[model samples]
Target: MVLAAACTALGLWQLDRRDQAAATVSTVQANYDREPIAYDPSLFDTYEESREWMPVEMTGTYDSANQRIVRNRPLNGRPGYEVLVPLRLQDGTAVVINRGWLPIGNREAGHPDEVPQAPEGEVTVTARIRPGEPVLNRSAPEGQLASIDLAGYGAQLDYPMHAAAYGLLASESPAPATTPVAPAKPAIDLGPHLSYSMQWFAFGVLLFVGFGYAVRQQYRLDHEDELDAPAPVRTRRRPSSEEEEDAILDARGL
Candidate 1:
């Protein structure tokens, strides 16, 4: 019973997590398929789910001097780097733009140094809706230049930045002549928690069923020896030969 209760409590806890995850996914989906809202990019400084897929337009001058190359990127199965440049909007707010991908060159030239340059001055650009950078499995070591965290990226470049780590810029869509690629978006998968809840519930049932079999086996074994036996005498057992003689002499008062 205790085991069953504990399992049930755990199942309930997982269910709660499942619900929260579903709601988050739903909110993102709704935001994605809808039209753009003229919201300040500040709303996404913290990467809220509601702001996901909200198509945003910002007119800004890009800072190309401090551009970053997101290494180990993939574009249509080709190895590449995601060009990251900071955009200072007309109103003086900074937002990071993921200006699409750049195919990494052969080791002869090392990483490509001839990636497209973001023009200076106010350049109006559109960014398809997205959230922060993907969590890389093996990111660069602290303060190392290979690949850096968003905050550290800003710090390394001496940036006066605002909100989120990455944004795929509108002007950088893949062309037919180049490797096919899709723009980056926040990681939004949320079904695994619900699947886990089901597994826990199934395990709880198996525990109850196995315990019942054990109890039934014990009961059957306890009663097995009695099926063919007669009832035992309630009185004490009869005396042996010497005891009987003693009893007879005592009866004659010897």
Candidate 2:
């Protein structure tokens, strides 16, 4: 019974995970390729979960002096980092832009060999909105971040920053001669959570079914032995030696 209860709990947990994954997939499907809208300070001042993956366009100049690289970002199984440059918009407020992924360098142990530069002058950028990640306890070298914690990154900058969200680069006008590899689209696959939940549920049910089968077999075996037993037999007492002698004399006289 204890094991069955545990299995049921685990099954429900997996189902919850499946529901979350489904919601993520639905969000991506709904917003990933929608028409890009102009960046609105009012609408984007605070991060919204539903606005994630929605494309937004803006004109800004890249602030390369304060650019930073996010450490420990891997792409296609290769160790790498992501380049982040603050884009100064027309109204003086800046938004952090994640340009793309860079491979680890050979000359340096933890740094990238070369980081592709963002366009120098004012350029139009189309990017998908992504909420800022939570700060990690780990530390990184100078000019590198442990994660895309926008608030922490904003604190480092001297200008006003939109710390609520960051942009995943979609396209830029007047592209640079060389550019970092673009990030791949989010996978809409619903993973194995559903199947795993079903397996756990089946295990819980089978536990009771097996217990009942064992109980029925035990009862049958116990009753069968009792029903097949032989009945008790009666015995006559043996005659005494004197009785035997008297019976012999009587038989002769007869």
Candidate 3:
């Protein structure tokens, strides 16, 4: 019973995970390629989960001085860093932009080989909305960050910032001489959670089925043992002495 309960709980947990994954896939499908809207500062005042991956356009200049490299970001199985630069909009509010990925450097142990610079001067950028990442509480070298914790990044900046969310660069006009590898699109696969949930549920059922089968087999064996046992034997009583003597006299006379 304990094992069955545990299996059932695991199945339910997997189902919950499946639902969450499905929700993410739905969001990507709904927003990934939708028409780009002009950047609205109020839209980011409190980040909306449903708006993730929604494209927005804005005219801004990259603040290269406060640019940060996010450590431990890997792409296509190679270790790398993500280049993050603040894009100062016309309204004086800034939003962090993840330009792309850069491979780790051979000369330096932790730094990237070369970070492609963002285009200089005023430019128009099309970027996908992304919520700020949580702080990992991990440390990184100078000029680098452990995670895309926008709030923490904003704290280091000298100007006001939209810390609730950031942007995944889609495109920029007046392109730079070179750019890092672009981020890959989000996978729509629902993963193996559904199958895993079914397995766990089946296991729970099989536990009881196996237990019942063993019980039935035991009962049948006990019944067969009783039927195979021999029956009790009956004994005859000895004849009386008087009756025996009369029989002997009659035989002598004859």
Stronger candidate by TM-score (2 vs 3): 3
> Taking the tens digit of each residue's C-alpha lDDT, what string does model 3 give over 88-134?
99999899999999999999899987888889999999999999889
TM-score of 1: 0.64
| Residue 167 lDDT in candidate 2 | 91
Worst window of 10 by summed lDDT in candidate 3: 41-50
TM-scores, all models, native as reference: 0.64, 0.86, 0.86
**Candidate 1 lDDT over residue span 89-203, tens digit each:** 6666577777777776765344754566676566776665455653456654232234435666666665467646345554532222442234655457776777677777877
Model 1: residues >4 Å from true position, as ranges? 1-6, 39-41, 44-46, 71-81, 101-122, 128-148, 164-166, 170-180, 184-195, 227-254
Model 3 segments more than 4 A misplaced: 217-254
List of clashing residue pairs for candidate 2: none
Worst 10 residues of 2 by lDDT: 41-50
Query: Relative to the true structure, how large is the alpha-carbon lDDT of every model?
Result: 0.66, 0.93, 0.92
Query: lDDT by residue for model 2 over 58-163, one digit each (tens)?
Result: 9999999999999999898998999999999999999999999999999989899999989999999999999889999999999999999998998998889998
lDDT score, candidate 2, position 150: 91
